[model samples]
Target: MLNLVLFGPPGAGKGTQSEKLINKYNLVHLSTGDLLRSQIAAGTELGLQAKSLMDKGILVPDEVVIGMIDTKLNENPSAAGFIFDGFPRTVRQAEALDTLLGQHNTGITVMVALVVDQEELTKRLLLRGQTSGRADDQNEELIRRRVQEYNEKTTPVASYYEQQGKYVAIDGIGEIDQIFGLICQKVEAAQSLES
Candidate 1:
């Protein structure tokens, strides 16, 4: 299976590119944000818990996120692959993910990180906030906190994948199609190795 982790901070275009990659690779999209949103919309207890932390621009607890991912993995037993978007935010989460995939006889093929500067990310997120109506996105202070959180908490996960020689970085400041094309090249290269 061509499992992949789409790595990036908020407003790095992971959602936009995930759609394209899913269509091209026939990979199931396992987006933690979408998963949490569904739970929140349903008013589930888990949703309420996630909402409290999310409202403060904080990450939902790892166990909660992992449990959700486990459910998704079980729901799709014969998936061609999966594109994990906005997940494995911590090295511990990455290790847990590796264990989960191992139980299924597969592993992350690559981690493609969209490299965008903090200032640019802040600008992109503010523009996105205007339309997204997501409270977390609308506030400048929250957006900066989100970016800083990613830098402090999530960037280390890159080194985890890098140690496995499965990390790829692509410039995220460009035409959408152009950036995606770069990602596709890296993904295809990894897929070839898998075969």
Candidate 2:
């Protein structure tokens, strides 16, 4: 399995790059945000609980997020691999994910961290807001908060993976395809070593 964790701040183009990588490599794109949105739209019980917290601008409980991920993994047992985006936002979650995957005799093969300047991230997010109509992206304060949260919470998860020799940082300031090229190169290198 070629499981990967695509890590980056909001507007760092992690989502865009993950899409391209998935298309080119035949990896399942498992975006936590998209999954949560689906759950919310479906009005599942987990969605209802998460919705209340999200509506108030609070983080969803880790357990709730993990439960959703567990469900998805169970449903996609036959998938070749997965590109996990917007997940394992903390070291605790990272450890939990390791345990979950280990139970299946699989583990994360690589962690790709997309590095972009804060200014560029803000600019991209503002433009994305115009097209995406996402309230969080449209509001500058919220976007800043989200970026700060990612730094405080998610960055350490990258370091954790780095200690395990599974982290690869990619420059995220360029055309979409350019950024993806860097990522693909790193992924191919990592997979070759494993093979």
Best by the TM-score measure: 1
Q: What TM-score does candidate 2 get on C-alpha atoms?
A: 0.94
Q: Score each candidate by Cα lDDT.
A: 0.93, 0.86
lDDT of candidate 1 over 1-195, digit per residue (tens): 999999999999999999999999999999999999999999999999999999988899888888888899999999999999998999999999999899989999999999999889989999988998888888899999999998899878999999998999999999999999999999999889878
Clashes per model (N, Cα, C within 3 A): 0, 0
Residues 90-149, candidate 2, lDDT per residue (tens digit)?
999999989988887899999999898888888889999999887778888777877887
Question: Residue 113's C-alpha lDDT in candidate 1?
Answer: 98
Q: Model 2 lDDT vs. the true structure?
A: 0.86
